[model samples]
Target: MSLPNAVDYSIIICTYNPDRRLLERCLNAVSLLDTAGLVMEVILVDNNSSSALYTLDYVQFFLNAVPHSKLIVAREQGLSYARIAGIEASVGKYILFFDDDNEPDPEYVQVQKRLHAHYPHVAAWGPGNVNVDFIEGVDDKLAAYATEAFQDRHEVQIGYSNQRTWQGCYPFGTGLCIKREYFESYALLAAKGKFSLSDRKGNQLSSGGDVQMVLYCISTGAAAGVAPELKLTHIIPGKRTKIDYLKKLTYGTSVCYSTCLLEIFPDHLATIKSQMISERKFAFKVLKKYLMLFFDPRPKKALKLAAYIGAVAGDYIALNKPVPSGVLWVLKRLKAI
Candidate 1:
């Protein structure tokens, strides 16, 4: 049922105002992939970057070096929109999404092909071994958290499951691989105005699209997993290593948590509602418990408090309810309102 010239994989790199050095390194790594006998295409989607990045010398050189490669300018300025553009343009059986800063190993494509053949039931999968290559050194206090943040599946095994949540089972956005058909379905939903999460637009770190995708996969009876053989290096710039950046990232994820979950798993409405209420209550308790700590000189305690505040805000937004007086008082006391 396959066309004679059908591509096996489509590698989609979504970027917006990317760092030139990081992009060059990413392109070089992609160019070195062992795709000798494999039919593949590289789709670099520029998500409303300020300049025409495809016209750059290094990018032009890369486009010439790789066969079946092209650049697409997504007028929409969001990772979700860029990825949807790539999905619509792809003709491969499997679609691989790599962030602009991700560098796949030489054997990445081959490993993915093998995994697809071996685990036909897995609709989405990601790299279990995601090494971080930080351009500059990080603070000693933030080093451990930064490492944990960047790496995926540090000690998890490779297997497929229908878990609804993305704790240890689902993949993130760094090097996410999925069946083209599944993504086509996702795109159709987006087209219908059902999918509205614009992940990481501009510099605002509102993220949930990847989690939505994983949950959608599970909802559709498809298994998702992580494979250690699939490897990639997530390049981290010095700016993202700062405590403030991490705090913002945490808050962003927390704020989008409830909305993403409810959107994908509507059938579990009652259960999710109950969970949200419990979480909101717990968040208030956490804020109260850390009221004094928020004033500490160290920013670490404030970061922890911000995550709980974000969760409470997310729940209130999702449920269409106003913040309770007590919670508002606590938030005000912590100067987080």
Candidate 2:
């Protein structure tokens, strides 16, 4: 039951130094949202941007145009910190998180609210159809692997019971929605130092806070789901399509995978030790995988190899084991160690 006169939803957009055009597009889409009968508030979190975002003309316009909208600055420099700031300031029953580059369909909030009603057992959910719109065209090499950087979940239909079957079933943070109660619990855990994933500090692509949130929800006997009706466009800048950028993203994601595993499972170390392979064998595997990069040499293949090596390094750090010399050499060459 909702409290009397309480806001129904809090739309939180967390961003650092964002592109002006993209921010304008995002806010414009939000301003046009179909919010007829629902009580909603938009909270724009400036995550330590270099400039004063609240003073920007467009930002001021947005704040004045939308009822109950305001801009809050987060002194911290990470995405997770900005999100925490948003959570702390929100009073809505449900909280929605959107990136500055995300543009939702006009009916996104309504659709999300309807779906939540349909799946009351779910604690969190997001859009199933997340499409990418590139600001500029890419070369064939970069274009082939460009989509991998974004998400498209049109074919996925998941419920709480099977949320853990695959990572795809987990909701991406692009347009994630969570019950305020569950999010408050997560915030408490974070405050107590129990949850420590600070995702994407400034330009660094490190992630997994979204995954951690979903895992925590599931651990609390709740469910998560995705709905095709909840749609959004992830605007991608041309610079991010470069091979070097993709490689960095791959490495960051790989490390995040290992970090999240260790965070959620207390027995993770025991499990890894029990099934550990000899250092020599692991070194040989790394060498073999690296050699494949020389043969295929495609951007996609290179990224795949980077992800594998990153995962290995992440495991080494997480387990406090010495990285094999060969793996160490590879990581140094990739500038990821």
Candidate 3:
């Protein structure tokens, strides 16, 4: 599990039965990175995919084809466990939390290294732009919102900018860069048992692992930044653009967000309680949006509204329930939810 001590950056790509075609594209992009002077290594962590990865001739051949890249199996199935394995096995000062579907620019590694050198206190940083790959035939309205949401980020500027906190910024796991020092010291603690309130589990869209790690790093007084020069392409498949999946993702995201919010800011519970709005107001808003979008006769628009309402309901449910600790934790571990 040990790596050479001289590696400057370790790109850890975690996957669990990922789309073979898209995974190849992601690996191809990594292999093409312009690393003329920088010392980097790509470590692919397999999260116990059901289809025995090693048995696949193409997967083995692909790993061998990529320079300075190797495949390591993380027996655990969760993304957090795979990430923990990668972080422990890596020997680089800087770590990149890359997903199997993300493709980085040619100079992505170099740009991240330069930014790390400039802002040593910033624990985790991401690229300035994350362009989504929306294929044809996807819902046009959903694709538009997805694209807009991806591009709307102000945390890490291109050349020079101050570090931002969780208050205003959140970088997804794709192409996210973190300092190994901070992660080893503080962020790892948040990933303890069942990795509670963490990011996307195998089939569940529930995600907050990245945010949980970021919040932990922020608590340690480390700033989060963004680098515009380090561009990355997020491959969004057609299935993800569907209304059903979007609704599930949004609901899971809200649940994870609310859980992490309580974990990271337990002291703010009283403040949150005081600031809570009436249920009637929430219902009124939902009814208004439903009425406004229902008669529009646009199926996509109706689905979008349904997804939003479902997510809001998930958020309200999570906000009222306290953090999962005693009985709730047991229920979660048993998949009773």
Candidate 4:
């Protein structure tokens, strides 16, 4: 796993049974990136894809096409584990964590390079636009997110961002850039059995790895930020537009939110209790706003409220039991945990 000594940026794309068309678009965009004199490397981690990726030439095409790029197989079935492998294998000063379906803006690298040079802590993520090209009958909720959630184009320091709002400064493992040291520290912590959360385990919606990493950075004097210039277009397929998937995603989001809260405030019962009380108050306020639906309900409005309830439940559950992490090294070798 030895790498060249002078690599500037390391891009890690973690994928599991991805759509070939979407992946191709992502790689196409990667091919066109203007490095601007900075040396870069791209590490593609295949998270136990059952598809005939290598035999079908999808993996081989990139090996020959993208410079300094190689495919690594992460037998583990979780996104967090795949990312850990990438962080361990990468050899660059800075690293970008990208999903397989993400298409970065051309100036993404250039802007990120500039920001990391100026900002010392070097932990951050950029917003992503929704690419609805392949989607049919695009869901209103999904479309609204692209324009509304990531609409802001300014740079916001992490702690100061709207933590209460869903569209906050938190990074979601897409187009997220951080110094290599931060990722190394995160991997070390996980290896030491300090923490664990499922940020998409197989077909499940559970997610918290990115959030936990950011929390770690904040705890250790690193401040993450929202760098608008490092934007990407997240390819939204029809599958993710389904109601069932959305519900699951909403639940996962809530669970992760609560899980992170528990991890951060592991100190005192009073502090955790107060935060939970505040959370319930916020949930009650949301329910109150949509209470009229009991008499005259709109499907969309009802669905939205249901998702909120799911999150509240997740918060409660997390208080009692949090995700555990161990045997990661053994899993890396055995491909099962």
- Which regions of candidate 2 fall more than 4 Å away from where they truly are? 1-4, 156-166, 335-337
Query: What are the per-residue Cα lDDT tens digits for candidate 3 across 1-337?
Result: 3445588888898999888767877888888888887778888888989886777776777677766778789996678778888888788878888788888889898787777778777777877777777644466667665565334343345433223224545455668888888768644564554236646778887677777777766766667756778788877777767665665565455556655655665665665566555566655665565566546746455545544444444445546643323323322322323
lDDT of 1 at 286: 66
lDDT of 3: 0.67
Cα lDDT for residue 223, candidate 3: 73
Q: How close is candidate 2 to the true structure, as a TM-score?
A: 0.92
Deviation from native of the Cα of residue 18 in model 3, angstroms: 1.0
- Candidate 4 off by > 4 Å: 1-3, 128-134, 140-142, 145-167, 275-297, 321-337
Candidate 4: worst 10 consecutive residues by lDDT?
327-336
Q: Supply the global lDDT for candidate 4.
A: 0.66
For model 3, the run of ten residues with the poorest summed lDDT? 327-336
Which ranking of candidates, highest TM-score first? Answer: 2, 1, 3, 4
Comparison by lDDT, 1 against 4, better one: 1
Model 4: per-residue lDDT, tens digit, 50-100? Answer: 874565476688778877898888887889899998888889998888787
Instruction: Give the clash count for model 3.
Output: 2
Which residue ranges in model 3 land beyond 4 Å of their true spot?
Answer: 1-3, 149-156, 159-170, 191-195, 277-337
Give me the displacement of residue 90 in model 2, in angstroms.
Answer: 0.8
